[model samples]
Target: MHEFTPPSGTLLGVGLGPGDPALITLKAADAVARTRVLAVPVKARGAESFARRIVAGRITPAHTVLELVFPMRSDPEVLRPHWQRAAQAILTHLDRGEDVAFLCEGDPFTFGTFIYVFREVARLRPHAPVEVIPGVSAYHAAACRTLTPLAAGDDRLCVLPATYGVEVVETMLERFDTVVLLKVKPVMDALLDMLARTGLTGHAVFVNKVGTDEEAVVTDVASLRGRKLDYLSLMLVRNPARVKEPVLRGCRPKVGA
Candidate 1:
């Protein structure tokens, strides 16, 4: 008699899009439909998962929902071990030939928790079959909702987390034609000052939870003073006064000439 071999299941990183269920791609929807084990990331135990909420309608009774806690902290030392543990838990299901799909908000690869878990899974299980489905990032949705152009011909764009400090944002504003600042909660006050100082305050727009019921758009940044902003909020700034200095490739002319 021939021995029976159980095939390992595939690991899929599905992006749920910004915050709207309608934004979910058909491919992601199909993945959620066929998923036997769905892995969802939560900020803490017992807390609702935003990623899960984005695809709540797709989850069926046959799907085993697994909640993975990834705390809302910036410290890598604190986060790495937690994700490693989550990867082990998901791997157990995959080993049993159960297809696992990890739900992520926004694009899975863009500043999302799925990347950390995905890396850990790949490191531990090199031969594991894995696939990633990209979705609309928050900045994209925010720009669309606010009718702001991220960039045009010969324009430069810079996107970075606002946690890097006010000085970093100042530098980005000076260099790039457009700057998209994510997670602006930590340095909201400082950023407001920087924007005003740079004479770019009117060009900035703030959007929170785009396409959801909690969505709020603020064109007047001054109103943000002493206000508590949501963690999901972002700021998109455009600098029309910014000038790109031409880089001379040939020999420079004499100063006297």
Candidate 2:
């Protein structure tokens, strides 16, 4: 006699795209529709998740919603437990042979909370079926909204977390033709100063909550000096003049008459 085996449920990391419901891909929509359980993450209890809000209209009564509260902390020690707890919660549905879709804002692999939860889930349930659906990243959305081409021809691009400090950003600005600084809130002021000193103020653009109603774009980096911005804000810098410098390349600059 053949042995009977139960099918394990699939865990989907569904990326909703940058804050727009319109940006959700067809495959992501299908995943959302087919999944029996929807796992959403919020910063705190009672707080709304932008990820869930993106697909609010699509969620039917047939779907079971699970809210996973992840503490808003940068420390790994503090975040690990929350991730594990959320993973355990999602596993219950998977154990029942029901698919669970964890809603994520922006691309699931691009600094999405789904990455953490997915990691923990994988660790606990090694054989659990999991699939990731890619969505439009925040930086891509910001670039499109600003009508800025990330790179063209031989132009090199680099993306770094601005939380690494102004010194690191200063180095990257001199190295790449296009530099994207994510998580700009904590270091906005210092970054602004560095931009001014490097004469890249005019070449830089700041975007916050791209594709959302709270979206703000600042072409003038100087204006951001005293202003408070959202944590989701990022700065895109295209330093043609800096790129012309010989330090980045092995050539000397020709002075124009």
Best by TM-score: 1
| Cα-based lDDT for every prediction | 0.91, 0.88
lDDT for each residue of candidate 1 in 74-112, tens digit (9 for 90 to 100): 999999999998999998998998889999999999998
Q: Which parts of model 1 are misplaced by more than 4 Å? A: 1-6, 247-257
* TM-score of predicted structure 1: 0.92
lDDT (Cα, tens digit) per residue for candidate 2, span 37-144? 999999998899889988999999999999999987888899988999999999888988889999998899988788888988888888889999999989999999
If scored against the real structure, what TM-score would every candidate get?
0.92, 0.90
What is the TM-score of candidate 2?
0.90
Best by lDDT: 1
lDDT of 1: 0.91
